[model samples]
Target: YVENNLAQKTIELFNELKNPADVNKTLLNQMKLDDIQSSIPIYLSAIKAVSQIGDYSKAQSIFKQIPDSLLVENQIRSALIDLWGKVGSVVEAKLIFDKIRQPNIIEYTTMGLF
Candidate 1:
């Protein structure tokens, strides 16, 4: 079924995000974001990996490509915040954190912990 396929693809993408040295851009491009809200987790993981690898520009570009709706999630937004912070963009990170409607304790903790 399409649902099962999407789930599998999402898991694969998540694995790539966690270990971006193994990422295949061609395969990543095949994923259909419109069919999977769970893509947010993979996207966040990719952002973290890219930032850690000193590819902040690429991470920012990918973040920008994601829909505004997708960016609204706490996990995704938290990743963005962290990415911006890693790049020394504290102002942008603060702005994003402030815009979050209902930031949970984890979001607060992440901001402080980092």
Candidate 2:
């Protein structure tokens, strides 16, 4: 759905995966390592969709759904920097970028664009 540029549909499909209320700590605790790892990309896609909509509040909400373990990932933070920047929140993007110990090419490129 995302590849097709259907941002709303992508978000709908993502939301259908599980209830919003289940996206908290209890959900994280129930997921295995494999599940967490695999879901990272899906979460990233959802974030992208939210970014395309330019909804900062929705972006923040979708971001909060990501597992803490995933936040440490460079790709995740990079995507977030892009998302926040797209939604007119450079400050939030910078905050995430500042947390990265070693920014990669993608992160650098993303920050540069903003």
Candidate 3:
């Protein structure tokens, strides 16, 4: 029952990905209540969808709402940086890079590509 509920929530949020601003964050508030990003796939999917449509600012806003502890992950940070760079937000990219706790080679390499 627990697994089914999570899967259902993910599906509901996936539909909302079409327009992130329209996303009812309340659905994902469980993560905020837990003081975590809660769902990596949701965050990544939102970032990817927003970036594809050239909405970096919206993506950044979503990324910012996620807790810093969860943001420490290289994949999440790198993906955000890539979105920033893609939309010519180099400063945003730099800010994210500086925020990394201890960026590894993959993070360095990913940022370099941006």
Best by lDDT: 2
lDDT winner, 2 or 3: 2
lDDT of 1: 0.66
Screening candidate 3 with a backbone cut-off below 3 angstroms (N, C-alpha, C), the clashing residue pairs are: none
Stretches of candidate 2 above 4 Å error? Answer: 1-38
Model 2 backbone overlap count:
0
- Candidate 3 lDDT trough over 10 residues, lowest sum: 21-30
1-114 per-residue lDDT for model 1 (tens digits):
145566676566657564462352323355543443436656766676666765656666666667887877878888888877777777777888899888888778667755
The best candidate in terms of TM-score: 2
- Candidate 3 segments whose C-alpha is farther than 4 A from its true place: 1-37
Whose TM-score is higher: candidate 1's or candidate 2's?
2
Q: After superposition, how far is residue 35 of candidate 1 from its true place, in Å?
A: 8.7
TM-score for all models, in order of appearance:
0.65, 0.67, 0.65
Candidate 1: which stretches are off by over 4 Å? 1-27, 32-38
Residue range 5-96, candidate 3, lDDT tens digits: 46675576657665554363444455466444456666776577667667766765676666676687777888888878777788888899
